[model samples]
Target chain A: MNHPWTGPRLARVALLLAVAVFGPAAGPRSGFETMSPELRAMQQDDLANPGMLHVAEGEAQFQQQGCTACHSAEAMQGVAARYPAFDAARDGPIDLAGRIAQCREERQGRAPLPREGKEMLALSVFVAHQSRGLPLTPNPDPRMEFVRRQGEALFRERRGQLNLSCGQCHDDNAGRRLAGSLIPEGHANGYPLYRLEWQGLGSLQRRLRNCMVGVRSEPFAPGAAEYIALEAFLAERARGLVVETPAVRP
Target chain B: MARTLLRVPGTAQRGEVVEIRTLIQHPMETGFRPGADGTVQPRDIIRRFTCLYNNRPVFEADLHPAIAANPYLTFTFVARESGVLAFIWEGDNGFSQTETRALTVA
Candidate 1:
C-alpha cells in the first residue's frame, strides 16, 4: 500500500541533494572519493547514536555471549542489501540465516542454531537494523534467470493436494492470519526474518518449505532449483521495499 | 484425526536420512484442572504411540501433559530402507487414530 519512487532522474536528483548536504559543509572526505574516512564515520555515529529497543538484546547476546568472535554489527551493515544472492561457491543462493549458520558451523567452531529460534531471530533482527533505510538490492545474475522464472511460475500456479498456490493465501490475503498469528503480506524481502511465535529467526526457504507442508505438498530440497526460482520471484516483487532484514514480525 | 507424512530427505541415497512427521487431531487434554465448576476434569489424552516401519516397530514414545495438543512427531531412519511409516495413537478411553505414508528410501 506504500507508493515508492523509482526513476533515473529521481535518483540523480537525490544524489545531488546528498552531495549538497554532505559536501563542503561537512568538509574533507565529503565526496564519494574520500568516502570512508569521514563519511562512514559520520554515518556510523548517526546510526549507532540511537539504536532500536530490540537490538539491545541481540547486542548483549553477541558481544557478552561471545558471538562477536564470528560477527560484528559493523560487518553486517548493508548486508541485507545483497542477500538471497547466488553463491557459486555453494552453486546456489542462500538466505541470510543460512549464511550466518554456515559461518557458525564452519568458521566459528560452534553448533548451529535451529533454523527458526529466538537466538537466530534476535541476531538477525539486530543485524538487519544495521542496514535500515538502505535500498533493497538483489543480484541479477544471468544464470539465475532460469530458476527465477520457475519460481515466479510456481508462485502464480496452484499446487498441492489442497489445491492452493502460495499466492492465493499470501497475495490475496496479505493482512490476514492463519490459526492465531497475523499473516504478513509474505514478501521474501528481509528474510531470514525474525518471527515471534518461533521466538526465533530463519531464512525464506525455511518458511517456504513449511508452507508446502501446510498445503499438503512436498517441499523442494533445501537448495533446490524450485526454491531458487521462488526466491528470484519474491526478490523481484520486493524490489524497492527497502532492506529490513532481521525485521521483527509477529 | 490422524495425520501422516512421507518425509524423504532426498532422492539420491536410499541410505540418506529420511524423516516422517505425523500429527493427529486430538484435544490431548491433560486432565488435572477443573472443568466448568470446581469439579475435576477427567484426564483423557493420547497415552501411547508407536510407529511401524513396514509393520515392525521402529519408533515409539509415551505421551505426557507437557506435550502440546494435536501432537506432531517425526521419526528419522537411514535411507534405502523402503517401507511404510504407520502411526497409531491410543488414549485412556480407548480413543485411537491411525494413518500411514508409503516411503521410498532410494
Candidate 2:
C-alpha cells in the first residue's frame, strides 16, 4: 500500500499480531470501498429485515418528550457538521449528547438526562439521524483551545485497568479487528448507532462511557468534560469522515 | 417510500431568504442487508432527488450508499416569488414519490 505519511497509517492489530498497513492519503476511499481482510471475513448474521422501528421510537421520543421545542431541527441545520464544538459560551466543548442534555436542563427546565438512559439514547439517535453523509467539520475556535487540548491528552493518555490509550487501538491499530468488529479508524462520524452489543441505538458518549467502564476507568458524569474532550479530539481526527449519525453498527 | 418533512419558522415572510430543509423517509439500504441465504445484497439506494419551484427545477442530488436511512437535506434560496415547492425522488428499487407544499410571497 502507498503511504505519503511519515510511517504506516495503521499499526499491528493485536498485542501479538504482526500485520502492517499504511496510508491516510487514500484512507477515505479505501475505508468505504474495500473492506480490510479482517472486515471481509466478518459474518453477515446481523443484516436482516429493515429496522425502522427504533428510528420511529426515537422520533416519537424526540417529539413527545419536548426535545424539538428547543433544539430547532431547522435552526440547527448542518449542526452535526460542526461538533465536539468548543462552546465558548459554556467555556467547554459540547458533544452531540451533551447538547441534548443542555437543552433538557437549560431550555426545557428538566433534570439532566441519564447518560445511559433509554430516552437519552433514543433522543440522541433521533437527533443524530437528522444529519447523515455531511462531512465532519470540527470547529477549532480559540475558545475551544483548552477543551481540545484536554481531549488530545485524553486520547493519548493510558487509562483503564488495561493502561491503554485510545490511540493504541484507533490510531495505532486502525483497520484491525478485535474479536469480530473491525477497529474502525476512530472518528466521530457515527455518533449514535445501533450497536450489536447494546442491541439498540446509543450515542458516541454512551460508547465512550461503556469503554471507560470496561477499562475500569472512573466513569465521568453523563455529560462530563473529559468525555467531551475525547469527543472533540475524535471529531477533529475525523475531519473528512462523513457524518453517519444514528447508524446501524454490528 | 421516503417521507419528506419540511419546517419553516413562523417568522418566515414573502421575499425572504429562507432555509429550505427536507427529510425523506427511506431505508437507504447500504446493500449490506442480508437475504435468507446470506449473500451480499445488491445495492439499492435513493439515487437522485429534485426540488422544483412552480414546475421549474431548483435543486437536485445524486446520492450514494453512505447516506443514512430517511436521509435529510437542507439548502437556502430566495423567495421573491411564491409557488408550489415540489419534491420528487427516484430510488434503485423503482421507487418514486412527489411531495408539494404551497408558498406565499408578497
Best model number under lDDT:
2
How far does residue A244 in candidate 2 sit from its true spot (Å)? 1.0
Q: CAPRI band of model 2?
A: incorrect
User: Where does candidate 1 stray beyond 4 Å?
Assistant: A1-54, A64-71, A169-185, A190-210, A220-229, A245-250, B1-106
CA shift at A57, candidate 2, in angstroms?
2.3
Candidate DockQ values, in order, are 0.01, 0.03
Tens digit of lDDT per residue, candidate 2, span A1-250?
Answer: 1111113224212211322244543443213223444322221111221123445566888788786765565555457668767655687678767777777888788887786676777676666656655567777587766777788999899997988888898778877788876776666665666554554456777788777786788777867778888887777776765555554455
True contacts kept of each: 0.00, 0.00
Worst 10 residues of 2 chain A by lDDT: A42-51
Q: Which runs in model 2 stand beyond 4 Å of their true positions? A: A1-22, A25-51, A68-72, A179-181, A213-216, B1-106
TM-score of chain A, model number 2: 0.75
